[model samples]
Target: MFAGDQNGLQGDPRLKAISEAIRVVPHFPKPGIMFQDITTLLLDHKAFKDAVDIFVDRYRDMDISVVAGVEARGFMFGPSIALAIGAKFVPLRKPRKLPGEVISEAYVLEYGTDCLEMHVGAVQPGERALVIDDLVATGGTLCAAIRLLERVGAQVVECACVVGLREVKGQHRLNGKPLYILVEPRQLTNCSAPSVTIITRRDQLSYYSQDSEN
Candidate 1:
């Protein structure tokens, strides 16, 4: 069983709002997987707003020059944080998704190898960037994003995610870059297939399956 570590964001009402908004789906895309679905969270206006507000409050004072968001879900939070922090938002896309000259970085996933790309000139050298994603599992995608930014000479300030699977130890792959997350996974039982308790940013509580190995 995994112990709970709330990252000290516990007890904040905003954490409760965000926690309540998420929908957990079990055995999604595969068996023994519990997917933390943010689409449900997006439906709640107040909860979504609170999620953005939490990120904005953190980055507003940091002189961030770019917000590099991973393909889809990161799109939800990256633009808001970029706008709030007076920075530009850049999308790190999947293979061949963008037009014009591009740069690519390949990384390992839980299943296989994949690549991420960005427009060649989207970010200038020496810019400070923050990488955003919906969650961090094995950290493969975020590592690719960081490499993409560094290839352009952009300094990665940090990586942010809404949720993290503690067992995966994705944070270790960050090359010492800081990772900020709203929730962390805690195992609820001693069974081989355990359910998980999620400790929200404000230490608000919720539960989901631990089936997903990512």
Candidate 2:
């Protein structure tokens, strides 16, 4: 997602596609659980490029020297974004994920807790950075990442996400340093009806239709 004060930026089509690509699955990994899935968006070239373009346009003029993405899914769009902005990509990995000399920090997740590690010498002092992810819940992971960056003397310029739960207090954890998301969870209610469906390539358009119909 692209960060901005207003939603009517130059990338509305991209935002719409991203909003449509997101699927909500209930009871994932356990009962009483709902998961926000972005795989659909990632798999679609137009949508993925749209997402990348939005971020690129948002930070094109900003002096961002590095783009640090959290582990796993963050790697999907992070490096592309870094390349788009002419910035180096940095990874904040799970414990023991990185090989060589590393730095680590522990953080709480909405479900439990985990730790992140980075190569100690990766980020230089006074570097400018942006953090991106597909989704944010409690903001714990992002905060931990920001702390890690600060510890290494890098200045975090902003935080961006594709989907955000506005009802939650996640943004507060960032200390109001310009949090941005293409779609807020609150907006889900605005759809005629919202449903999650697993669609094959042949049924992709139908899936989007159902999303709007629901």
Q: What C-alpha lDDT do the candidate models reach, one value each?
A: 0.75, 0.71
Q: Report the poorest 10 consecutive residues by lDDT, candidate 2.
A: 199-208
Candidate 1: give its CA RMSD in angstroms.
Answer: 5.9
Using TM-score, give the best candidate's number.
1
Off-target runs (Cα >4 Å) in candidate 2 are 1-5, 8-11, 186-214
- TM-score of predicted model 2? 0.81
List per-candidate RMSD values in Å. 5.9, 7.4
- Model 1 lDDT on a 0 to 1 scale: 0.75
Residue-by-residue lDDT tens digits, candidate 2, 1-214: 3332354564555666776776655534333234567787778888888878888888888999989998777788899989988999999988888999998988754346678899988999999989987776557778888888989999999988877655454679985667767775322443333333221111111121223432
lDDT of 1 by residue, 100-208 (tens): 9999999864346778999999999999999998877667778889999999999999999887766667778997888888865333233344464332211112223
Q: How does candidate 2 score on lDDT?
A: 0.71
